[model samples]
Target: MKNASRLFLALIGLSLVVPVFADKDPNINAIKARQGEMQIRAHNLGPLIAMAKGKMPYEPKLAGQLAGNLKLLLDLDTSRDWPPGSDNKSYPHKTRALPNIWTSYPEIGKYGKDYATSVNELNAVAGDGLEALQSKIGAVGNTCKGCHDEYQEEHQH
Candidate 1:
């Protein structure tokens, strides 16, 4: 009887743990998708930022290509990557998206639209000249900062 009771308790414990582990994969995948998209945006924007800062020589053709790539990335519908379970409250350290994102849905959409507009403007003048690119770069950066400030949680490390 003692052995049976121990086995029953162990089975109950295992059952409780199993659902938690099962639910994690979808949340993990969503977080990864969000992170991956951000990484791609950074990759597309890195060269333009370097050129704008004079760290790299401004190549009009390359700048144009990068800007176009950025526009394409911005064009993606990213809402799907931000399901409720993917928020920091659900996944903790694995995701930086704050719970406020779900609550502030309208603001989030506005920010996304504003970012798309800024990127569109950048795409238009990317190959014009260094001066043109420099003028627009700050706006693009500001849009990113605005969204990040409101929607993303600060990283402690």
Candidate 2:
């Protein structure tokens, strides 16, 4: 927790010190921005899943920290970064976001709301106990898969 706080503070300080420049290409920048956010989400989620699956022992402090970090992400205003024409069809190998994300309109909004709901539910119980965390995790996973199924481009392994 102390490490996370220090990192967060350092990032905030760095942002203030660093010179801000407009992106030469907003489309590529937008794609990178949103993908970075998703990567952050996945980074926090991996450990929770590992503990839930018994691949790692459930540590309440770490569980809470991870879940808390996810909850913090909910405050980000990333909608403006997801401009149309920034998907896989346009960026090719640069992104897996399908064009449908923009065309689907409110359909994608529903998925976002579902994801927020699931994340909130999970955060509420994550530090309570292993059983509590497990109970709400499937809903969160389902929300992610639901969105990916509808909008993300599939890659063959």
TM-scores, one per candidate: 0.82, 0.84
Query: What tens-digit string does per-residue lDDT give for candidate 1 at 53-148?
Result: 999999999999999998889767876678876788887878889989988777788888889899999999999999999999888989999999
Candidate 2 — which pairs collide? none
Best by lDDT: 2
Off by over 4 Å in 2: 1-20
Task: Write model 2 residue lDDT over 32-112, tens digit each, in one string.
Answer: 889899999999999999989999999988998998898899999998779988989888998999988888776899899
Candidate 2, run of 10 with poorest lDDT: 16-25
Q: Local distance difference test, per candidate?
A: 0.88, 0.89
Model 2, position 16, has a per-residue lDDT of: 72
